[model samples]
Target: MHLYAGKKHQKYILNDCPNDQLLFAMGIRNGLTVSIVTKQPIGGPIIIRIKNREIAIDKALACHITAKAVT
Candidate 1:
């Protein structure tokens, strides 16, 4: 599903992502509240704000990260 911009939610990690080891080292673990900063066009990357840092991740990697909308 497409995540909306300016949305706030807690990331839901399904399994350990060995490919993104740096994410955990950077403190981007499960349950972390992430804000959808912005999204690129034509299935481009997505800029997510987490822990006060804004990181751009591609669509492929974005699929691995899931979250639920915060109320």
Candidate 2:
């Protein structure tokens, strides 16, 4: 199954990101959370809501964002 937009996923703690994702990781540490806001049907950037900020990230980068399924 493919991941669609408007889905709420588990948070990937900022402390968990690798060295390369320093900036992305830092944001999370500052009370930031992310949610999939939108997705382009034609393999476009994935829009994510981080706190009050909405950032559009490419599919590849989006996948790298880790989130666990909540039961």
Candidate 3:
């Protein structure tokens, strides 16, 4: 699996990911340490984990937020 680290976080995007299968695949491929905080209060950071490692602030704060919002 390929990994990309962005400003705030690290992620691997599987294009055309089918349904919730994306999450499952990501978890397994990356060691199942992911979480989604969709309805948290504003300014509260959303936590996304991968392979027991935390992502960067920029990727987590920017890219991850954008992806989660859209999906």
Output the TM-score of candidate 1: 0.64
C-alpha RMSD values across all candidates: 4.2, 4.8, 11.2
- What is the clash count for each candidate, in the order shown? 0, 0, 10
Backbone clash pairs for candidate 3 read 7-58, 7-59, 8-56, 8-57, 8-58, 8-59, 8-60, 9-59, 9-60, 27-32
lDDT of 1 by residue, 1-71 (tens): 33333343434222333358766666666666677767788988877776689877777767766555665
Candidate number achieving the greatest lDDT relative to the actual structure? 1
The TM-score of candidate 2 is 0.55
Runs off by more than 4 Å, candidate 3: 1-34, 37-40, 55-60, 63-71
2 against 3, candidate with superior TM-score? 2
Model 1 gets an lDDT of 0.60
User: Using TM-score as the measure, what is the rank order of every candidate, best first?
Assistant: 1, 2, 3
Name the candidate, 2 or 3, with the larger lDDT value: 2
Question: lDDT (CA) for every model shown?
Answer: 0.60, 0.50, 0.33
TM-score of each: 0.64, 0.55, 0.26
- Candidate 2: tens digits of C-alpha lDDT, residues 1-71: 12232364433222233234644554643234455667777888777666678666667655554553323
Off by over 4 Å in 1: 1-19
Considering lDDT, where higher is better, how would the candidates rank from best to worst? 1, 2, 3
